[model samples]
Target: MAFDGIVVASLASELKHKLLNGRISKIAQPEADELLLTVKSTECQYRLSISADASLPLVYLTSKNKPSPMTAPNFCMLLRKHISGGRIVDIWQPGLERIIHFTIEHLDELGDLCRKDLIVEIMGKHSNIIFCNDQGKIIDSIKHVSAQMSSVREVLPGREYFIPDTMQKVDPLTVTSEEFAAHLTGKPMPLAKAIYTSFTGISPVTAEEICSLAGMDSSVPAQEYSADILLHLYTQFEIYLSAIKEDTFSPGIYFDGKEPKEFSALPLSHFVNYTRVEYDSVSEVLETYYSTRSLITRIRQKSVDLRHVVQTGLERNRKKYDLQLRQLKDTENREKFKVYGELINTYGYNLEEGAKTLECLNYYTNEMVSIPMDPLKTPQENSQRYFAKYNKQKRTFEALSVLCKETLDEITYLESIQTALDIALTEDDLAEIKEELTNSGYIRRKYTKKKVKIKNKPLHYISSDGYHMYVGKNNLQNEELTFHFAVGNDWWFHAKQAPGSHVIVKTHGDELPDRTFEEAARLAAYYSSMRGSDKVEIDYVEKKQVKKPNGGKPGFVVYYTNYSMVIDSDISNIEELE
Candidate 1:
């Protein structure tokens, strides 16, 4: 993610090695702010992709080719006219900055030998690809930056092309030890911040790595360090720069769980526990990191609508359940009303004509009690009215009890869907969840003659003891995995009283080892709503003991007894099968 100066330096070295004497065979603009050049080397053909995209500026060698428009853009046509058949003379980075300069020699329109430079600046929003003559006079750029748009420098035709030093950062490659110490001590920022802010091409991640290598706290202010500590920090910084200087780059991507977290030109020793997959080519690392990261982001955005539906349903059901409980509590006094009716009937014979009240000794509690009387009605009539009121309340209580349970079940179901969405990694996984919602009436089903089949399957993992474990990704998957796929001898595992994936471990008619049991519990806890908790209680029972209630919701199961264990949700060590 930190495409800093070191990465640019490494990329420049690679391009120089591959394209130094290569001829530009073709020039194509596949996007508004991108160029794909086919370079013909003596050994092989390479596609050099250069992008000045405001969001994702990149320059890399790619094997993939993109479709171009029928008419080329002005910049692409200009490059074709000047350097289409030009030989790449040199490729270099500018003093550890995130910039690459490609020098080319070719015949001009006037049949005279000329040289031009194609410069790519990977400066985030300010990134640009500018074509310039040997004198550093810009001919044109992929993006035009007028004086009004940027006062620092203009990237228009005929303007002087230069890298603006607005940050006043010293180049790490040439910085002396004295200057390094002075910059660190003078800055009023954290150690890592000071390091990155004082040096060109050093990102915050790299700064942290430097601090980590020096065994210093990156959060501490740089000025707070002692003189000796500052010297030690500088030593570590030199060691880091030495790797880039010696061209001993270890290009790789770091992964947390299954997600790509970071990439570096050199091994990030700071990420000690993360899985680092080394690559021979830095271009491969960049491409893999960006594509995978973009996919994850895209999937999250796609699931937002489904998440909103689940959230809204959960909110409505939860509110209704609270109200139902209150109404049900009101009916708790229905038995007292029935007793009032009985006491009134028992004392009705001794009542005087048109009596206003009746006093009685209630046998229920052996206590004297008085019942209110309607002046115009007989005692028998009054008793009948009380009985009617009791009957109405008793009916309401019965209906509300059923409604409360149903609403509660609905909330749990929606929550399970939410958890499934969190666990979803692909489109088919989402399709299964959407189908479940449609069947359960949370979403409207689209009418179609042909039903689309979903190919999403449960997550399969192998325990340390070599036992195979399956985890359901959604409610429907959980049902399918538990009842049809699993055997009676297999073991079922889930997070206790929580919405999660159903994990079924195949025992294969042999007793499961304790290690396998704990691993299964970890998997169950990891895919549940309590995944963030330090420890989650898990329930594991034989598949035979778990039963689906008649007409119950998918994935809804009950068991009389089960073995319980509390485990952490760290399944990073667990081996997952594709």
Candidate 2:
């Protein structure tokens, strides 16, 4: 998500409207690198949060206030001493850069009026909150970057406050067409990169949006753009920068499936494929995007251990299955041994007591066969030896065939669990998966004998034709959906021959519309392993036709007959129910 200059500009506009002429009533530093200020405006009280965290630099108007430490830090105390009752005169951004300057007027110790600038730079690792004199010379900062840390500029006391790494960018708000053309022709980078690199406050997302608006390919070099294309791109740039200049902004977040993907100050038109969640306030958008994205990332990290276990189990069982298949193939010749024993017993009476070999016609194939015998043994003894060899091979085949089937079944079950983990979204979803693993013997049950009640339920969606579609989130859910929830004549869909969610389309004793069938097939394809494939073959059958073998693994089913279709995995048009 980009918290770029446009967003900062919008935020600056909002602050100027709300905090200008307001008094700084209190200052608190709850975190080592964070500051929470309570501003008292004529209208109401506002809590402004500004963080200079190296990992997450943020500036937002929050309703919640954090508890401060018993002893404030040096920076916090300094801010309190100087700006405790200062009146905010102006709030502004510096030429589309990710920086905000707050000008304050207050009385000094001798009652002399003085002015200071509280500058907050939102650059990633080099972010800092520096208190500067009216001349823009640094007084003190939350973070002081010495000459040893950065050669470009020193941010210590008395040093000049200049934005690093953005000194050369031409402000998009002020660039002329000639200037734009010069910069466009100067860079031999991709269209998107050139736009962002040449202009201040333009992020890669905004650059791509500009390219999309101009109908130019973002990946192609700017040099490859024709003169007319360049003109068109410059027109689109003006359209966007004009909005920022006019103080009109749209704050929103884009979502991929149900997960928050990115947020921006302006509508992200380039993300046509993702769902858009719009907000009236940029602060709200930022807070929601970061918090939701953080939770999704956290859940994925937590599932890594379970994923590793499933992957390792799948690999081991797959290898064992291959070996068992080879062993089963070896036993394919077991029937030949039994046939040889039969021929020997039938023709052995013609052999003399001292004969070393016997030749006879095999009745099974009407072909000649020879059996070698031990000269020291009688014909009856030789026949018994062949019979014993045949019986041993038959026993080996019987044992290995069962073992091979079990290994294959285990492999399939593990794969289904892996797919479930992929679509898992919450802690409860993961809890259900863990429970399934424990039941399937992949995970050992805890000795405490306490179980976490599973609240995770199947995905529910309504088809365009108004039919209900239920998708299993795990193998256990698949079993529950099919055996207990579904009934005869209800349609079931799965990604044919691939691991996927069990999609049951409820018929309710009525014929399902064609649109409903298509929607259910799309759901089946999207939640499966082949989700992003161009085409996924789906098998749809009546729930009654989908039968589970007794004692089979959860979600394991057999369908002797079914209807099939090839469909894409895009389910954006389908409406999902909570």
Candidate 3:
């Protein structure tokens, strides 16, 4: 996420090496604020994509091509007229600023050679792609700014194009140690904040990383550290900046589990326990990181409605389950009512007329018991009344016992669906879950002549012992994987008494190794509803021992004999197969 000055410098170096003296073969304005240039060099043909979007400004080399409009925009036409066959002379960054300057040499209308500069400013909402003459006079831009829009500088035709000195931050790439110490120690904020605020184009992420490299807590105040410690910090800062100076860029994306958390042109040693995937080039890093992030964001947006549906279903089922359990608790006194009927029959014959109470010896526990009576009713009638009440209570208990069990089963089924939704990574996964919901009557099924096809497959992984493991992504997949795909000798694993995926390991008739078992158990724990717990209980059994109940819900299975283990949910080391 920190596409700061260092990233810009890396990109500028890449572009200069690849497109230096390269001819601009094609010009495209795919989006209003974006440009895709086809540059032909002696080495290879490249597509350089640039975007000045207010929300997301990006510059990356891509192989993928986007469709341009039928008619080019005015700015596109202008660029095609002036610099269509221009050769890139230089590509550079302006002293650790989030900006890239490209100088192109081309022949004018009368064959006189001319040079123009294309500046891409990545300043968040103020980002712009300004085209200017060699004298720094603006010619045209992808987006124009007037005095009304910004009082600092205007990006219109014939206006001077310059970077605004808004924050007055010093260039970190060339700052001396004495100067660095003097400026950083004077700040009143935390150490990380002071570092970012004192330097140009250094994001808070980078500042924290710098502090981490110095082995200092970034949250401490800047002035609390002594001069010796400050000098050590400066040493670490120089070491970090040396990577950019030597052009030994190590580009990669850091992943927290499956999602990309951040990407950098240099090593981020402070991001402990995160997965760092190294790339050969910064363009590859940017393209991979942004595309993956976009897909994750798109999937989350699409799942909003589906999540609401599942959440609503879970809430309703949970409420019903609680109420049913309470009602079943009330039926616990049904046995006492039956005993009262017997005691009333035994002692009613000796009761005096107009008596309000009868004292008797209960045969059940051989203890003395007193039964209340209706004074106007005969002993026979009193006993009959007690018997009637016992029969009603018995029927109610019988009905509620079955109802409570059904409600509980429903709650468990809905919870499994909820867990499936949590791990849903693709539209097809959500579709399969929706189909399950429709079949289960939670959602109204729409009748059609042709059924929608579900193409989601179980997640596949290979254990360190070379065993193939498959994890279900939804309840239906769980049912398919456990009952149809797995054989008798294969092992099955699941979170103990929790809604989770059914993890099946293909044993090929051999007994699983202990390491493979633990790995499979970890997979079960990681995919379950209790995924983040320090320890999760897992149950494993042979496929033959795991049986689905007749007419049970999908993914519902029972096992009498199984092995249990407690393990953590760290699956970063587990090798996943596509």
Candidate 4:
């Protein structure tokens, strides 16, 4: 995520190799704050996209082309007037700052060859694309920063073009150990923060990496480190800068679970615990990382309403289940009341009229029992009162037993929907989930009354033994996969006693291999609510053994016989059909 100076340096190196001495064939402004230059090199055409957006400033070489407006913006026309058909004589990065300078030579109106600098500054919020003359005087910029906007610097025509020294940061490429150590003499911030703020182009991620290489903690204060430790850290810092100076960049992205977390031009050692994906070019890393991150983010935002619906259903059902359990506990002593009534009726024949209490032998546990009678009533009347209490409690217990089971089933079904939401990747996947909620009455259908199109299909995979396996994304899909898609002998797998995906492996009447059994178990574990657990107990049985009871929920099934296995939830090696 840190589009820092080292990335700019790597980009400069790549651009120099691809665009240096190349001719600009076309220029277009597809966006107000963006420019695309089509450059023809030795045998290939590279589209260099430059964006100076206030939110996301970017510069990268892309193969994808964008359609431009029929009319070019004023800034684009100015750039074309100056550098159209220009040959890129040089491309360089200043020190380790987040800037790229493209020195272009083209014929002027006077038939004389002239050089102009197209400088792109990728500073966040202040990033701009400035066109300057050979004399370092700014002609114009994609964005204007006037005195009213900032007192630090003003970007305008006829003004000298210079990178603002607002931070007074030293160049990491040339800083000596003394300069590095002296700058952080009294800084109270963390060691990693002090390093990045004191030097240009070194991101906090890389700073933490330097500290890790030096066997120190980045969270520790800078002033807490000994002189030797500081010197060791400076040495590690030099190694990173040296690599950058040598144009040795290992661009990669680190993932937190299945989502991309951070990316950089250099290897991030501090993120060793995360999943790292490497690429050969900085542009590839940036493009892939941001696109995947954006797509996932977009899907999550789209699933918010559906998640809210599922979460609300889950919460309501859980509360009802808890209350039912409590009421059911109150009925646990109802059997004892029934025994009391029988004992009273048997011993009442020996009791005098209006007796206060009677002691009698209880046959249920071979122990003596005491029965208290209402003095105003006859002993038989007291026995009748006990019988009335017993019958009421017994009825309540019977009724609550069925009601509690339904509540718990609703809870499990809602939990399965929540798991489905987490596994959703595409909009179509979300649409299926939402449709299920609507049909189940948890969510109200929209007024448009559109036709229900079943676009989201169950996930299909090929096991190592060449067996076909399918996993349901939601409960409705689970029913369809198990009942409609699978045959009687197909193997059905699910996490034991947990809400999970219903996995079906088509056997085709052929004896299944041991590998296929394990693979199906793994899928069952991976798609369950216990997906994060190291090992999940899985229940596997033939589809014919699984029965859908009358009036059961969509995914609910009963099976008296099954085989079990414990498997890890790793599906990385499983081949999935898109």
Candidate 5:
């Protein structure tokens, strides 16, 4: 679910409650698509994370720190100059249009109070972060859009900042009974589609929830409903809207067919009674769902190539093993053929020229060996029998040769895969490793067409300063968290070996004290499959040192000199993420 409007609205609400009247102590763009805002409230300090990546745009309060480029990007410097130490006056969402605007009041260079607007558009494929002056003139944006970049609107400096219009059919929260009745009277659309199309704030999930509350089939034809039924639905929808206004929301799951699949904050019982139902706050629902989904996506994408490489090796080994087994069988057949040939040659002349059978003295075993032949057999027939046995033995030798070569090749392939899996640190690397297994026939492909499960759980650790560190389980996750989730100046750690996950320590820009390093080391050890060894060799390198190898295996990298340590593999001291 690409950071839909509802999630943004929930986040904006949370931010407003926590950050209003708070001063922005620091601002940093640790990554091009991510922002970390340090807000100082009277009760506590808050680290607000905002990301504009289309797949997982989010605004959440976290306690984690991240690593950033040594030299701040021009954009980072610009934000620091303009908005640092600003007081957050308000957090506003534009009627669930996938946009959040932060109104900040700060002292200008002349020491005069000024207000600036920081707008974040959460719409997928069109998401952006723009900084505008009080006059609504965009000073700069995270992404520069010109007439050339977007024919629809130019987002460069000096342009007016305005929300782009999205055509919607109805106001879900304010639609009157008469208006809804008029819209649905002649339309023959599905109930879910009609509601979703009618309202700007209504997602498919919400639409289904409305249908559930009204006791109507979400898939039922809208035109088929009786006027009385329609009136009932409108009344129910009004009640649902009232619930939203009162903030009395519940989380529910949705299903396609029998599988309990998608999750939502609206009750989907009207459409299907999803067996796996859970209730959570609107904020909790967005945070948990998007966080897990983002993590899984990161792991799969980052590990894709590495998994492929490993799986390919595994497959080659399996084939080689099979071929060797076949050759072993053929070799046994050859030995039998050799014995047959020797017996025939020894008993050939002992019998009459046309003899059907003869017994020969076995010189080696001190026993009689019997040779049988065709009745009235000629010299040519006797010669043919000996030659056929000889040929069978020769064919066995050839099979053995091919088998030896294939076996060696397979061994080499298996070894490579093992090595790759050992060095895997990130979810991306794991994804590649898993893919390799699937491709090599080690694991069967999952039949469901939806996204594959990339990482089972995030790699977790406690830093020396008691900060939590998270490592991605696959490539996609690595990209998401490392580049999109982490803040600048936080220590980044990775195993020095091969393709691995990108480990991030959320430091909030404080210098990493020693305990953090040990915690990170433990994480590196546990995440690798070599988790049971007494001492596992780990290479601790800054995330900046880790460079993705070009066209290399997913999560594969080349790092310069890094700190090395041999740490005990026990991870009991580290806390696992829930």
Candidate 6:
């Protein structure tokens, strides 16, 4: 769900407090839809990120740096020339709408200080960054919208800056109980649909939350509610409105059967059985969701080729194995046929000359034996034919047995690599994985050079209880963390039946409590590619029991007598080290 207008207002307020009077030290366009502004206030330097991407428009503070275009775009150059040393005077939002305006004081041509407005609209498919002169005339914009783009209003150079008038929806902050009741009775919509449709800023998430607080069915017909039920619903809605007005909000994800059903400012109805986890602020929610999604996206893009390579190898090995298995089965059948024919040739003469079957007493052992042969063929001829087939099959079986074992081994190796690729966390880890695939011939090498040895880096996380947890992002890191960084008493975790990073909990030789185990499991689950799944089975064991299998793929290992738990792949609680 997108951030509510109230949340955006709160964010604008916070940013105003932090950024007002700050000098613009640097400006860069790190992406087509994003702008990074480095500001220096008297207290500290801050990096503020603003994005107008149609899918996810946001503004937040970040510590990360990104590469920019070598040659700046015309819009970027214009912004740099005019706003280089400007001071942020104020930050405001438009009537709880998805729009933020930053007024900056900058020196004009005559050295007179004047204010210019930088407007950012966060509305989906209509988001834009517009620069306006003191008179509110548009100078330029990241996107130039003409009459063709929007029939209601055109956003172009020299045009007067005006907010477009769209269809009006009820403002939740100003809605009265009578108005809400009238609207509900006028439409035969579901309770949640009524709330969402009638409100200007309320999301479906908030509507569902209101229904949950009222103990009413979100999917029930709005007009079907009794007077008492409607009154109760109105009271709860007022409480939610009051919370937003006071800026007292909680951020959490609501789950239905361990799957995230909604992320919202209030508790939701569909996930009433889910335990409510709390966060300190709405900013935390934004940061966690944005960063985690961004990280997963980056990792997936980086490992695409490596994953394809491993899959190809796996398929090839499987075909080879299947062929060899079929050959082995045929060989066994042929050998059995030969043994029967030899018995028949040795004893067939005691019966009629073209006999298909014979029963006779052995002279030496005084025992009976039965033999069968092809009725149209001589016994000697039948024996020769069977012997020839048996010899050929025996040789084929010997060859196939060796090849089958090799193919099976290759399949196991490729599968292990596939697992590692799935768990890769960072670009560096992906590079190492690709190198391994290339060395094994799963990936073709474009250039031959000496292997680059990079120092292993551990993934660091601080648990909810303040205990430190370290995870290995690659095989070398895994070895270092388990053997060098971890002590005997440290706890370890891995994903069951999945390729994943190794997670180690460093206790400093102190006994780990039960909460620590769950925290470690979350880390182990989150670090793997399966982090977004409803449940990830994690196996935890003492550090001493963990052993890397010989010739195993990177990050492959075996452990025994460990404890296991099915946990939600939620890292919302874990704090990653900077």
Against the true structure, what is each candidate's TM-score?
0.88, 0.85, 0.91, 0.87, 0.53, 0.70
What digit string (tens of lDDT, one per residue) describes model 6 on residues 141-219? 8888998888987889999999875745776777777888877777788989888777776777778878988888989
Write one digit per residue (lDDT tens) for candidate 2, span 243-274: 88899988888876667878888887878767
CA lDDT of each candidate? 0.92, 0.89, 0.91, 0.88, 0.68, 0.77
What digit string (tens of lDDT, one per residue) describes model 3 on residues 1-578? 76799999999999999999999999999999999999999999999999999988999999999999999999999999999999999999999999999999999999999999999998888989999999999999999999999999999999988889988899998898889988888988899999999999888988999999899999998689998999999999999988888988989998866888899998888887678999998999999999999988888888787778878877887888788778777768777767877887777777889999889898989999888889999887888887787788778779978887887888788888889987888999889988998888878888999977888899999999999999999999999999999999999999999999999999998888999999999999989998868799999999999999988999999999999999988788899999
lDDT of 4 by residue, 467-509 (tens): 9999998888899998898999999999999888999999899
- Residue lDDT tens for model 1, 1-578: 66799999989988888898999999999999999999999999999999989899988889899999999999999999999999999999989999999999999878999899999999999999999999999999999999999999999999999899999999998888889999988989899999999999999999999999999999999788888889899989999989888988889999865688999998789896577889989899888888898988998999999999899999999999999999999999898779889998888888887888778988999999887888789889989988998999999999999999889999998999999998999999889999999999989989999989998889999999999999999999999999999999999999999999999999999999999999999999989998857789999999999999987999999999899999988787899998
lDDT tens digits by residue: candidate 5, 401-503:
7767656645543554564455454555566556766655667788776876554455565654678798766554555665567755555665544334567
Best by lDDT: 1
Using TM-score as the measure, which candidate wins? Answer: 3
TM accuracy, model 3:
0.91
- Which stretches of model 3 miss by more than 4 angstroms? 178-187, 329-398, 532-534
Once model 4 is optimally superposed onto the true structure by TM-score, how far is the C-alpha of residue 275 displaced, in angstroms?
Answer: 4.1
Q: Which pairs clash (backbone N, Cα, C closer than 3 Å) in model 4?
A: none
What's the CA RMSD for each of the models?
A: 3.7, 4.1, 2.9, 3.5, 16.0, 6.5
Model 3's alpha-carbon lDDT is 0.91
What's the residue-level lDDT of 369 in candidate 6?
58
True-structure lDDT of candidate 5? 0.68
| Range of the 10 consecutive residues with the lowest summed lDDT in candidate 2 | 447-456
- Scored by lDDT, model 4 comes in at 0.88
Candidate 5: lDDT of 305? 62
Q: Return the clash pairs for model 3, or none.
A: none
Query: Candidate 2, 568: how far from true, in Å?
Result: 3.5
- Winner by lDDT between candidate 5 and candidate 3: 3
